[model samples]
Target: MQFENTREFARQLDKEDKLSRYRHEFIFPKVNGKEVIYFVGNSLGLQPRSAKKYVDEIMKDWAELAVEGHFYADKPWWDYHERFSEKLAKVVGANPSEVTVMNTLTVNLHLLMVSFYRPSGKRYKIICEEKAFPSDQYMINSQVRFHGYDPEDAIVEIKRREGENNFRTEDILQKIQEVGEECALLLIGGVNYYTGQVFDMETITKAGHDVGAFVGWDLAHAAGNIELKLSEWNVDFAAWCSYKYMNSGPGNASGCFINKKYHNKKDIPRFEGWWGHNKERRFLMEPEFHPEPTADAWQISNAPILALAPYLASLEMFDEVGMPALIQKRNKIVAYLEYVLQEIDKDVESTFEIITPAEQEDRGTQLSVFLHGEGRELFNYLMEQGVITDWREPNVIRLAPAPFYCSFEDMYEFGQILKKGILSKQKV
Candidate 1:
């Protein structure tokens, strides 16, 4: 679709957008008495208007029922996490029995590693992308150390070729095949945080399984931004935070997916708690633990209902609009933004380059622009001008046009503001 860098064009597109109504669902941040163009859903999502109502209901239950709220509340605290299973399963493409809402992302990763990362005999090495999010790197590094192995020898990083911005799928597959004999697990980000490249999980999962390795993903950026098929891909396990693309509040509870293939495998190891115990026998408080025959079996503690309420509010919205609708708007708006950016690059002789993949299937909502000269200054100027985006070190600015809340008008404005920032930097 041809895109024009005009407010009229953007307004026309917005008028045609079926998802335009969703923009009103979120509370936008104010800048100079106007709402800023919020494009940071890949980091912290904007608060849903219904979030307060959800939390207030929970709080009211606690006030009226006190300890009895566990059983007596409108939505029982005892089974609060269960409410999210079916809706969340749709977002990540898994069965309700295969998905569970619980702990933070990194914590879930550690717990899953206990069962999936078992290194035996000659198969001990873990394959992951180089420069994964720091938390994942730290977790892998510490896990390898905990098992009494040198990280340098136990971890295999697939690095990009010199000066390349993203990993090539062929290179990644070749790396997997190269270390297939020694690799025990293949853990990678479903959508890379920096480059915004969406990995081919189905193929990668198949490659890992064929090579006798377990495969998993960190879906922090992938969960709500792009399509996921953890169940169909036969992924062994996966985890993601709700705060990012899921549009849950900051530090909100996360979701986990464990393929049903492992649900009935009682012999598999995992960290356990009372919440994971069989519901019928939970009240018995028996010494012998009978785990839930589902992904809930991985839970190590009771659900944090207050922290989870906001996520429920967000998930309801996701359920209404669905991923297919969201992905449709995402493609059109992102294409418009890309067109605008290319126009800017041509007209201004841009000092920056977009590091994200050009293919729609290979990327999601974000475009990572690696600014060369005056990048930081231009970023600060845009911030001052009320264009909300994220800045990473080494001169990259990430702009994500979230389909749920962001509008085509916002993208047009971003292009205008970005051009102004560039010109202002030149004058400086």
Candidate 2:
């Protein structure tokens, strides 16, 4: 699709977009009574208009039903989480029984590591990418220490080659093979947070399995942003936060996937809670833990209904639109954004370089631009001009054109503002 750096061309594209109607379903933040050009959905998605309505329903149920809300409320708090499994299963490409809504991402990662990251004898090393999310890094380090192994000896970080900004799939596979005998677990981000690179999960999962290691993913950045097939890819486990691409409110409940192959395995140890007990005998208060034969066996506590309400609201939209439709619009809009950025790069000899992979299949909606020499001053300029973007430390600015609500016009305006910001800095 050819792109033109003109407002009229953007307007034409917006007019033709079938998903444009979704923009009205979200409430955008305002600056001086005008809506800002929001491009931060890759970090925190815009709240759906239906979120308040869904949350209020839960509040009303709690007010009226009180303790009995556990069984008698409209949605029944006792099993409120059961409502999301089917829908979320579809979102992550898993069977309903393979998915469960539970704790936050990092917490779930720890819980899964308990079962999947077991190291025995000489096979105690864990392989992960360099510069994983800090939370994941800390969790892996602490878990390694918990097993009485030094992190320096037990962890192998797959790094980019000199001067390269991304990892090659072949290099990652070779690394897995190189440490085959010592590797106990292979944990990686499905989509890297810093570079927005979507890893080849299927190939990586196969490589780990071929080497006799458990493989899992932290899908915090991939869940609602890119296409995933946890089951088909044979991913042993995965976890993701709901706030980013899923548009749940900040710090809301997260979703987890445990392959059905492990659902009935009694030998797999987990941090058990009463909620994971068999529903039929759960109220009996049995001293023995009879775990559910589903992903629910990993739940360590009761679901937080209020916190999950907004996520349900957003999932309804996903259910209505389907991921295929969303991905369709995503490709075109992201292409438009890339084209706009490239046009700016050419037109102004821009000081920034786009570090994100150029291929649509290798990335999602986000593009990380590394400023050659400038700092946050240009980012501040864009913020003052009503373009809300995400800034990383040092000199990177991330712009995401979310398919759910972001418009082509938004991308065009961002390019215009970015050009102005660059030219203005040059005049300085």
Candidate 3:
């Protein structure tokens, strides 16, 4: 991983990358028809070219087969959804039966909340990070209110110590123990959207289970960004969107996970739909619900086969390169990014701080930079220079070097652009 300089280092690294072949699989963003250095895969991944072909297959199925496509056509649209469960499960570290594709992120969170976040009168509280994504916060708030409880009282928000930007594991474990008596469920983002902080799910799950509480995770930022073992971690339930690191396209169908332990539990109240019924009896149209004994029981609607097409294509790429192999490259790329940020003139580097946890295990693909004094104009300047990243108002600009498409040369170019932008802003 040693480098003589940025550009030469890029060609050398690309030479050694096992996943290097994946670069051509995607279509990068264009600015005035030129390729822009896209680092916002943490927000929206670059689309794969095969996505169109995947869609075309479904289109042909619809057009040629017409009404017969549902059950009698090749691959049978009626069971097409089943084809991907095994592939997706490989990515998220779950069994095929323990996963299902369905509604979008926030909607799936709401559906999972219906079955997992059962709050009783005395022990009714959700412990979540204070700076969680707005959609997750809103979902938790509305769910609390739906249960006839005040969000202010029912949602326990965790944060770093005063004047701190991130929460430490010790603090999180201590807080869970302190409030374990009242907490009904633990619902946290697998990775913080703004800070790029990756929570230790195994420890968090164990802490909640120790307190006799259910645990769930919002994997909007974690899935495809980091290696996850949801099944081995024994997480009770989880939901994630695929548009970001998953590269499924904007607002693509989301995937959800429910621990197999909950599948046979008769007491866990689920908001059931026909799609979640046992496949053996799905077409029976029986009045009584016969729920599947796996995460598929969480499904409330049919899979969006058209919307999920990109998932299949993108996942196929992961399968070819392997998830761990891609992550290995990201670890080096992200560390290089952090190094470049720190190498800027001391005065300039001090002007903004990277809020992402420094440890390799504590973050995924994103680096959330908090502007120390200059405010957001620096982010705008970078954008104007075609270094397309996402700015979360107030002060944070999230930079993500997606392994599938981002290059070391892109990161190097970004550093020069960033330094130039900061220098220009400082002169003002």
Candidate 4:
């Protein structure tokens, strides 16, 4: 795809896209009354226009039906949490029972830790990336300390080679081999928030198991952006937020998974609540905590139905497109984006670097561009001009071409914005 300028290229690509109609379903923000090129879905996805109506139903249920709403209504408020369960399962490649919607991301991460991270004398250390999402760092550190151990000693962080911006597969595998005997849990991001790098989950999961450790992942960035099979991967457990690529509203509900392998384990220690009690006799309120046999068994309380509505609406669209097909679309779109970014980087020579992997399979929709000497200035200039990409700390700009809605031309335009933004500096 050759282009004279981003606008013309975008129009042509949109015309050829099978998913072009999806753009109309979303509410894009206006910059000076014009639609800005939105490429930051990796940070916060655009809201669906239908979200208002979806949210209104919950408001109406609470207002009109009041107490009776729980057992009444078309979808039934009593089973309201189940409304999006099946669709949520389809999005993450899980059995209906293997997935459940509940809690915020960090809260769910803690709950999963309660059930999965059982530390002991010889095998009590935790393994995670050095630059994990800050919340994850806090979550793991707290867990390590909660188990009566010092975080600095109990927690181990894997870093890239001294001068490298990303971790090599062999580096991660070697770290696991080196620490496997002492590791109690291997917790990692499904996709690194800062680098936009996707790690090999299957191999990591296998290695963790080889040394008798529980393996879990935080899919905050990867869940809706990438294709995954948590159950097939034998991942002991995982959790993710839906607001980013899922297009759920800000602070929306999160979803989690437990491989069927642990579903029947009644002895698995947990921080159980009423909602997680056996569904059939939950109303009986017996003293014994007889848990549900599925992932629903992990739920600590009823979900925020209103907060989950937009996620339901978004997951329905994913169901229509299917994850595999969406991933295929994502790979091609980002490759086009990457190709253009490289072209521009070549034009500027050493001014910037693509910190994300060059290979398609090693990332989702996101690309992290590190500016050489003045990243924040370049990023702010792009933002002022209405090129909507995200800026991480120090010197990196993160752009995600969400496959369900982001277009090839949108990716093209972001590159052009960066290129033009840099060239404008020469005239200044």
Prediction 1 TM-score vs. true: 0.99
**How does residue 384 of candidate 1 score in lDDT?**
82
In the order shown, what is each candidate's alpha-carbon RMSD? 0.9, 1.0, 1.7, 1.7
Q: Tell me model 3's lDDT, rounded to 2 decimals.
A: 0.84
Select the stronger candidate by lDDT from 2 and 4: 2
Q: lDDT per residue, candidate 1, 1-428, as tens digits? A: 77888999999999999999989989998989999998899999999999999999999999999999999999999999999999999999999999998989999999999999999989999999999999999999999999999999999999999999899888989999999779999999999999899999899889999899999999999999999988889899999999988878888887999989888687898888999999888999899889999899888788999998899999999999999999999989888988888877775656668899999999999999887775577777888888888999988989898999999999888888888777766776
Q: What lDDT does the true structure give each of the candidates?
A: 0.91, 0.91, 0.84, 0.84
Our model 1 lands, by Cα RMSD against the true structure, at 0.9
Residues 338-370 of candidate 4: C-alpha lDDT, one tens digit per residue:
778777887763466789988878888888888
lDDT of 2: 0.91
Question: TM-scores for all candidates?
Answer: 0.99, 0.98, 0.95, 0.95
lDDT of 2 by residue, 72-109 (tens): 98889888999888889989999999999998999999
Q: Pick the candidate with the highest lDDT.
A: 2
Candidate 2 lDDT trough over 10 residues, lowest sum: 345-354
| TM-score between candidate 3 and the true structure | 0.95
TM-score for predicted model 4 compared with the true structure: 0.95
1-428: candidate 3 lDDT, tens digit per residue: 55534677767777877777778889876776768888899888999999999888889989998878788766677677777788788888998888888889999889888887888768898999887888888889999999999998999988889888788888888889988778899999999888888999899899999998899999988888889899999999898998999899998988898888888777888888988888899989899988888777777777777887888888888777767988899898898888777766463744668888889999889998877776677777877777898888778888999999888878778888888887777676
